[model samples]
Target: MDSKYCPDCGHPSSIKRIDRKYIIHEIEHVLHFERGILYTIRELILNPGENIRKYLSENRSRLVKPIIFIIVTSLIYTILTHLFHIEDGYVKYHEVNDGTVSTVSKIVKWIQEHYGYANIMMGIFIALWLQLFFRKFNYNFYEVLIMLCFVMGMGMLIFSVFVILQAIMHFNVMSFAGAFGIFYCVWAIGQFYFKSKVSSYIKGFFAYILGMVTFWIFPVIIGIVIDVVSK
Candidate 1:
């Protein structure tokens, strides 16, 4: 696998490998604090409202609380991304001149420079739509929105961790795949916990739609807010 090093932090690559045993170990540790982490991940993946129901039902100690999880995960994920400078795709660079440039070439160049904003917009909408569909599984609209706040927050945490990894360790693996894999692991544990109660298709589809959408939504919202407030 391709790897990198962070010049600033000098934290070398410590990841040994990705494997079933390792994953199980991680889940086991999480189970100690919250058994519901497995089911939360599962409902987050398969049946959106189910997790919320369990969470609200006083099975409180069974999993990592969503709020805390979101805060920690977002920080780690963003830091990793920042450190490694991972790119979903390349951004076009354009030169800027003082004030205004009134030419076709200049306009195109400006657009290229600013094009990342557009990609972010599309990503947010798609993620919201996926969450919306998943919410239809059992949740009403408000609940779905609430769940999305936490879910998307987790995605931000994941990305923030990526930024940290990039800055501190010069680590940048494919992040979306990493997100999907982690999401899958969470779902698997939930399935095991729930046994025959939840449908596989529900789990699979939920992850597919929400995973990609969450990836885009959080950052875009933050970016928009910053832009609006700054103006």
Candidate 2:
């Protein structure tokens, strides 16, 4: 009759069954949902800097504890995409009805058409640039970069799963979610990274603005580079 509280809502668990497998599975599901909501809540509640400090100073698990959250969020994101069929006008080459483009060509064309690939890469760069802007805070440049890289890895993990879902359902939500999600997750990382760099609250806010702007502009700059490289 031992009982536990729900990880997500902090509600008391009313175990419906005493079977070990069922209990274990149920607990895992609760923790998963709890993690996603917690990540979203924390991001919404604190300005980037404070959130970072909170994770940094507290338990190690708090830092980048968004893995389970990311998976859950991504799955829900996939489901919604399937249901709504939101259109960003991105089509894989072979899927195009015109039949003029090879699959690789279509992928490249899709990247060019919807501004997806570069925009996605820009999201990562913005996180890196933000970290550099606040280089004097505490950690070395590499350390900040590593943290951002981890953020990107987490982002790609969720994004990959979403892409798989899109393939199966013939719906295209992955590009939009991946692009925007990378921006947010990286920004989340930057929020904490800047706090660690700058001790003063005021400076941290400035860094946040700079980071935001850098994120917005990064795609254009990288697009130019890609255009040049392709030439």
State every prediction's TM-score relative to the real structure.
Answer: 0.38, 0.42
Q: lDDT per residue, candidate 1, 1-231, as tens digits?
A: 544655668776565687998888876664443355445554565654455566555475654655555544444443443446554412222436667433433443443333333323333453455445444454444443344444544445444444544556654444454565446434542342343556544653465456545544454465556656766
Scored by CA lDDT, what does every candidate get? Answer: 0.47, 0.49
Which ranges of candidate 2 are over 4 A from the true structure?
A: 1-36, 39-43, 62-64, 89-98, 102-123, 140-231
TM-score of 2: 0.42
Tens digit of per-residue lDDT, candidate 2, span 51-70: 44554555434434433443
Candidate 1 runs further than 4 Å off? 1-52, 60-65, 84-138, 149-172, 175-231
